[model samples]
Target: MRRRLRVLVTGAAGLVGAEVTARLAAAGHEVTALVHRTPVLVGNDGTPLEAAGVRCLTADVTRPRLGLSEADHEALAGGIDRIVHCAAITDFGRPEEDYQRVNVDGTAHVLELARAGGADLVHVGTAYVCGERDGLILETELDEGQRLANAYEASKLRAETLVHKARADGVRSAVVRPSIVVGDEHTGVVRDYKNIYVVLKLTTEGKVRSIPGQYEARLDLVPVDYVADVITQVTERFDEAAGRTFHAVGAPLTLRDFSDVMAEYPSFQVPRFVPPTSFDLGRLPREERVYYERVVALYESYFRRRMAFDASNTAQLVARPAPGGGQDFLRRLIDHCLESGYLGAPLPGVADVLARLDLTGADVSGPAANDANGAGR
Candidate 1:
């Protein structure tokens, strides 16, 4: 039998954090969900955490002692067995200072809390911390002297460095670095539609005509549920995962594969991929250029380089298989977006068009479709 541990999770309002909280609760673990502004501890389907017997606390990771009062700090210090530090600003457009304040400084504060509580730390970082380096990225690799794409990457790298330093100081720790997290594999339901969805939305809405990218560059995307599951497993088996790093990523899709999936939608404009070095943003019309500068410019590095993450450690630890990739999964995601009105209302007769194209399947839509694989809610 497994021990029922009292776990504290930070950033429980965000997508990955919320899912991790829910999964831990479902696994019969005592969970204390820490949030900043929003105190409502509800899952994606509006299920309250209290119903699952999970405790919710209002706190700030950027503050000393995580903004906990003397009584609360003593309680946590006495009872909390593990700390899952998932709180960090993930936006790319945020200023460098914001990234430093949240990702870097906030991490240090969390480390102090773990030190006080004598709790094992499970730090959630990003695979992009490897930065602009090419070839395979190992779980043990950090600070390869590679150029970062943005401040977000640089800040995450610094935060992971702090975790490593803490490990050396005798704080039992494990780091899980996930790539671009997307919707659930079976349900295709996502709390937020940012990152890759930004490009898909612009293209599907016919807002962008051309993009600067390499055709062969691969986009590493993983499902949020898979990431949460991996984290939970690591936390449960901390004795084995301590002082190690795991990559929670799956098979990546190339730019060509992405374009091919978009091509299936008749109304979607498949942007012509131009060499990043030769592509000029000034050549675009005013509206497109403005949108590119505001929304797409921050992710320019992702389209230009291909970075592969080696998840050998994660594979060895996780019993379940990783989520599937390729065009089939991409199609399911687009169909879910259209059905949920996330990508806006579907065009007239879009279902008929898909039927005529022979793209219909049992995994296309509805709750039954989502429940087929028992993967996600």
Candidate 2:
């Protein structure tokens, strides 16, 4: 039997963090959900974490002692046996200073809390920390002197380095580097529709014409549930995962596969992928150019490159296989977006389109089909 632990989870109100908190609570672990602003601990299904016995506390990771009172700090230090550091500004377009402040300096504060509490630490990071380096990325590798795509990538790399350095100071720490996190694998329920959804939304809305990318470039999208599950598992088996890094990723879809799936939907106009060198933004229509510059530009670096993440360490620990990519998963994600009204109300004649495509399986019709309005509850 796994030992019950008091786990302190940062970013407990966010998408991935809330799921982790819910899973930990379901597994009989005492969860202290640290939230900076929103104190609600609800899952995508609207299930309250408080109902699941999660203790919510308002605290800022950027502040000293997590912005907690001395009494709260001492109480946490006494009670928290493990710390899951999931709080970080994930917005790619944010300024460099924001990334340095939150992803880098915020990590330092979490490490201090872990040290003071004498707790094992589980740090959630991104696989893009490998930056512009192509080919296979191993869990053991941190710095390869590769060029980073954005401030987000650089900051996470530095944060992971801090965690690695903390191990030398006797802080037992493990890092979970998850690739682009998407919706739930089974239900396709998602709270936040950032990251890959931006591309889909822009394409489907006809906001952009062409995207500069390699058609064969791999897009490593993992479900949030899988990422959360693996992190919770690592926390449960902390003794084995100490001082190790796990890649919480799966088989990624190539840009061609992504485009092919998007093409299945009638409303979407799959953007043609052009090589970055040959592609000229000036050639685009004025509206498309402006949209690309304002919105799509933030993520252009990712679509242009390909990188494979090896999750062998994580695979050895988790029972389920890594999530797969391709048409089925992509369809489910888009369908959920449509059903949830996140992508705006489904285009007219979507039902006719669904019928013509014959894509509706028993699973697709289970819950999503019942919601005709595609509005969020």
Candidate 3:
């Protein structure tokens, strides 16, 4: 018995935003998808949002009144009953001011729009706001004076603070923090591969072979669909969501599992893990040092942490459990990457390689024969 709501989804063109928009529209909610540059939104399954009765509006969240005409703003404010604030610059290593302007200030403007419309607000934040702290992270926790890992996390923390204050001031607001979002849980398909995918691409290519990490360190990866479903449920059941925080996260996979899964793929180069304290950039070759400094270093924090997020609050409200994650899930992600040609075609299997060799002239003791036999083994 969910009442149909007029929903305005900011960052509608983004990874999570796109899925959320599609789900809202499919669930019969009146959805207005706000985009800054890319007005066209394609769902993870390649379904176009425009065909689902979703109105795509070009608006900038960083601007006052969402960069809309005063009249248009008023009209939109009067029309929508819910605002799902999903817009933010998620790129790591960006200038601090870039995060400040987009993640922090943009939220302020969204808050204004929510207030003007007397709408319930659901703010999409990140679980990493728990910062560099290890062990269990509860939805109830926010600022524990924890040292943040990057500017992106810091900016999200500030934005979440704004939402909490707004809720206290009587604007019905809730926060949903999702851990690392990947592709569809079932299909392993994604709109765009960024974040951890970048690291995977580099590592699997043998560009950065050694990483500062621990085998037992955990990485929590959630599917985009699960994140979207939770948001949709929160919107449909605002009463249960208001004043609460939920962690939309899957089961964590240990670094050992990640390495083991990659090993299973013959085409993938399994990266060697070393203790962070013992690792030094100065000792690496010039080319490796440059790659590490520019790309790998940004995600180095994720490699060493062993934090686990508590999702009890999310379990109570969500209809289904978060997707299971481990070695198999990691394999699925890599398999999809290979299938989509993102990671390039996988190396030829042992049978294919053997069939291509002419046994009559093939020197069994030579480098080529030895290499092929080693690969098959």
Candidate 4:
């Protein structure tokens, strides 16, 4: 019988990292979780992973050489056979160098650790690396003349490029690109703000009042569990995926449908979605109009277009799905948001929505502390 494998995971405290930790431990692998610091308590849904039979260690990717002492590095190298990297800062609003620091340089640091341990590397990358791709984004296509939307995409592309560079240098590496990460379909458990969740927060806060485009953009979301499952499968079945890139994405949802679904609460009004020509420039104060203009510009680029994902390679290799949910189910997810007080209050009109579906994010959205304010009620 094959002996249990020793695996090292960076960013084990993150959404993908935490789920990956649970899955790996459940699979009977000896898992070592790497993190930068010990928070008061990891939001169970937070970045630091929690699971049975896993050893948690301290390590920061952004530091020089991963911020580890020689002894700690040797201790990790002594038993680790594979390395999974999922600890990138996906904030689109950050500067270029910041993204490069975590996404590019941090990846290089992880590769260095993998080399030290003679372990195969699994690199977590973003599907947005496709960069303004319009349709049918394939798995094997990397340099397909796609332009990056922001620093986040550009830095991810650079990081993936570095992975390939390491492979050329005789390092075994696998690249996993997940698109527009959402809450777990089965659990609705996402730990932090990234991807489409930010839109919900900003919109619900009334920061994004009006959109000057058709609410017809495609927002492709993949669940954390599916991503974790696929990552584990790829690690176990590394040979089939070595030197390959995978696109783990779902079918896209239009912008109008997305907003409507997230606004199941009557208190949370659906903002007006107007065509550019229909926007009344004279109605808003000049500064407010400029703010709206910025919102319009940002959303127009990202959440406003139709995008197709061709996951044929990932499909053939991992043989799993990207957890599909239409706007109706998404409304029920909003019901969890209200009940959990993540939105600051309960939804007045969500009794019907709550009755029809299960809400999983309630546990995921509440704060990590055993305190009351963490989750709302």
lDDT of each: 0.83, 0.84, 0.86, 0.71
* Per-residue lDDT of candidate 3, residues 1-377 (tens digit): 77888999999999899999988998888899999999789888676766566899999988999899999999999999999999999878888999998999999999999888899999999999998999999999999999998999999999999998887667898889999999888878877889889888877876567889899988999989999999989888889888999999988999899888888877778777888887866666554566688888988898889999999889999897778967677777777888888885546533356668844344322222212111222
Candidate with more favorable, higher TM-score: 1 or 4 = 1
Error of model 2, residue 284, in angstroms: 2.6
Model 1 TM-score, all chains together:
0.89
Every model's TM-score: 0.89, 0.89, 0.90, 0.81
In what order do the candidates fall by lDDT, top score first? Answer: 3, 2, 1, 4
RMSD of each: 10.2, 9.6, 7.1, 10.0
For model 4, the stretches where C-alpha displacement exceeds 4 angstroms are 1-3, 39-50, 259-265, 275-300, 344-377
- lDDT by residue (1-377, candidate 4, tens digit) is 54577888888877777777778887889988887775322533554435567888887898766887888777777678898999898765666789888888899889888877788998999887878878777777776778777778888888888888888777898988888777667656666645455456545754445655567767777776788888988887888889888887766778778766656565674555666666665455333345455444544567545667788778888867656776754664565555556764534433235545655344322223121111121
Highest TM-score against the true fold, candidate: 3
Clashes of 3: 0
| Candidate closest to the true structure, highest lDDT | 3
lDDT of 1 at 252: 86
Lowest lDDT 10-residue stretch of candidate 2? 368-377
Find the 10 residues in a row with the least total lDDT in model 4.
Answer: 368-377
Q: In candidate 4, residue 358 scores what lDDT? A: 57
